[model samples]
Structures are given as structure tokens and as C-alpha cells.
Target: MLYSPFLVTLTLLTLLTASARAQQSGPVVATPQRPPVTEQDRTEAQKFVAEHHPELASLLSQLQKSRPAEFERALRELVPQTQAIQRSKERSPARYESQLAAWKIDSQIRVLMARWSRKQDPETETKVRELIAHRQQLRREQTQAEKQRLTEQLQKIDEQLQNLDQPETQRIQAEWEQLSRRATIAAKQATKQKTNTTGEKKTTAKKSSDQQPAAAQPSPGSR
Candidate 1:
């Protein structure tokens, strides 16, 4: 199967993200049971696939009717990663672009695997391997990028540490103290108000009870 250059790029980006995560977490462990996928998750997954991989959209729909289990599994895989990619787009566009391709590749690979599982064939296996290799290359690139990012961040942190004794530090410290004191005051006021409100409610309730007419006394020979 011919892969679009765009798909190839996206697949690599996803692999890079995965590599970075795996490095941080160390060895992979058994996955814990995931929460049941919701309708909202399915919708989001569908939207994501529709946008990134239009071809897979129909496949997903078909899976839902003919292979419900496979459809759910596909959703479970797609939702969280797609959500993360969406967040990255909002928080960091460059990062989003870097990871987007990788995500696409990963999603495509999953779909392929699902298909292959049902009916294994040499052609499908070859495509899977090719995609996997493409994704790994992306992972390596992503890891390098992550390292570079971390290096830059560390440099910034070091510069900040070196400038710790600057006059701005004192100003910042004073501001922090002022904020903390204000927060303390606000919290105390809130607590006091809540306590007063509760006491007032109790007092009002007691007064209403006191003002109530007493129950009528039983007649002496009513029994």
C-alpha cells in the first residue's frame, strides 16, 4: 500500500513522543484495566480519525456493526492519545506538529493490526513492518528533540538560579508574602462567615421551634 508522505511524517512524530515517554517511565509494565470507553470518547476518536485518516473512518464504522469488540478496542486506543495531541496543539503548536504524524502512524498501525489479526496475510504483515520502521525512525528524532528542549530549559533554570540574588528577587519575595498574607486573611474571613451562617441557621431554627404551639394534651378519659 502506498503511504502518503504526510502520513509517514505524522507516524514518525508519534513514535518520537512514545520513545520520550518510554525513556521517562523505564520498562513497560502491564497495563491496568482501563475505564469503559464512553460515547463521548467514541465521538472524539471518530472525529480525530476523520480529520487525520479519512480512510479509517469508514473502517471504524464498519467495525462497530460487524466487530463491536474491535471497534471498542480501536476507540480505547485512539481517545486518550488524540486528546493529548489536541492539548499539545493548544499548549504548544510546534510540539503538536512534531507529534501529530507519529499519532497518525500509530493509529494507522493499530487499525492494520486489527485487520491483520482477523485475516493474516503477507502483504498486511509487510505493510505493518514498514509502518513500524517508519514510526521508530520518528521516535528517535523525537527523542533527540526532547533532549534538546530539556537542555535549553536547564540552561534557563541555571541562569535564573544565578540571578537569584538580584534586587528583583527581594521584590518578588515581598510580593509572594503579600499574596500569602492576603490569602490567609481571605480564608479566615470565609471560615468565619460560614460559621456565622451556620450559627444563624441553628438559632433561627430554635426560635421557630420555640414559637410553635405545644401539642394538645390528651384528654383524661380519651382512652
Candidate 2:
């Protein structure tokens, strides 16, 4: 229930990826395929965590010992750190361009993988597949304008998919919403518990200090 910023970001990214995959229309392929997470990708992630968030390496254990309030505080502290790290990485021109290219290809492959996984309803699935095939075809066009047109078309498709109301789409949306709500609620409860615990500890210490002074006072006769 103690969700760190890194965990939260990773979860959001995964959900967004799934949502992106679901919006496409595609025929079910025999084999599900996705772009492999290359060694370079792994290395980059590890390096980033090691250099920027060494505390994250022990985050799980820390969370276990932390009160809900402390956990929430930690998450709040981590958000800006995580953002700063991402911004720093993105500022590197060479790395930014390379990551951008890799992301686009990975996104396309993930869409295909989602289709193969049957994430879409049959009707929606077919439509997404058609759109994907069309995009692929457009990629072969040898002009910058043509490539730009392809981008426009893809964006239009994405917009349409977002607007499309269907039982399956609603179901997926509801599930994600529920997950987000649960995480929020858990964090709130943890914060409240931690606050109460801290208050009690303070009161107990005060009482103990007051009793100690009284006990140390000499009896009236001895004084």
C-alpha cells in the first residue's frame, strides 16, 4: 500500500501503454510479439536508479518499517526528485533523440503485441489492425510531408478511439479508475495512521517527562 513515486510512475506508464495498445484495430496474429527490452535499455534504467535514486534500491524495506504518514511523506519527497532526474536525462541531446526513436518503435510493437493478446473486442480489434496496417504502409512513403501526414492520420485515429463509447472500452476504463482510487485511499489511510501514532508518542513522552519531574521533587519534610 506504500506506493513510492517510482512505483507510481511505472504503474502509470504501464497503464498508458496498455491503453495505447487497446486503441488500435488489428487482426489477431498467431504469435504475440513485443520489442525486447534490450541490454542498453536495462543498463540505462539501472544507471539512472543507481545514480539518482539510491534510496529506491531499498525502498521496499523502508516502506515496510515506515508508518503510513512517513510513507506518504516519502512519496511526496520522491516526486520532484523523480521529475528532476527525468528532465536531466531528457536534456541530453543524443540520449533524448535515441530514446525518442526507441520509444516510437516500442510503441508500435506493443500495439501489435496487444492485438495478439486480444485486449480489444473483436470489432474494435479489426478496426485497430486496419489502422495499424495503414500506418505501416504510410511509413514506406519517401517524403517528409508524407511522413507528417501519417502522423496526422495516426493522431486523428487516436482521437476517434478516445471518443468511441463501447462496453469493452468502458470496462477497461473502469478497471484503471478503480486501481487508481484504491491506491489513493490506501495512501490516505496510511498518512492518517502515522499522524495518530506520532501524536500518541508525543503525549506519552510528555506524560513521562511530567511524572519524572514530580518524582524527582523531594517530599515536603525532606525539602
Candidate number of the best lDDT: 1
lDDT of 2 by residue, 1-223 (tens): 3454445333323333353345458975574563444545444544544453343434423543544444444343334333444664667754444433333333444433444453447765666566567555544542454577689999999987875655787868988899999999999999999999999999999999887844466779986
lDDT of 1 by residue, 127-180 (tens): 999998998899899899999999999999999786675799786997799999
What lDDT is reached at residue 71 by model 1?
55
User: What is the model-wide C-alpha lDDT for candidate 2?
Assistant: 0.52
| Cα lDDT, all candidates | 0.74, 0.52
Best by TM-score: 1
| lDDT for 221 (candidate 1) | 100
Tell me the TM-score of model 1: 0.54
lDDT of 1 at 111: 58
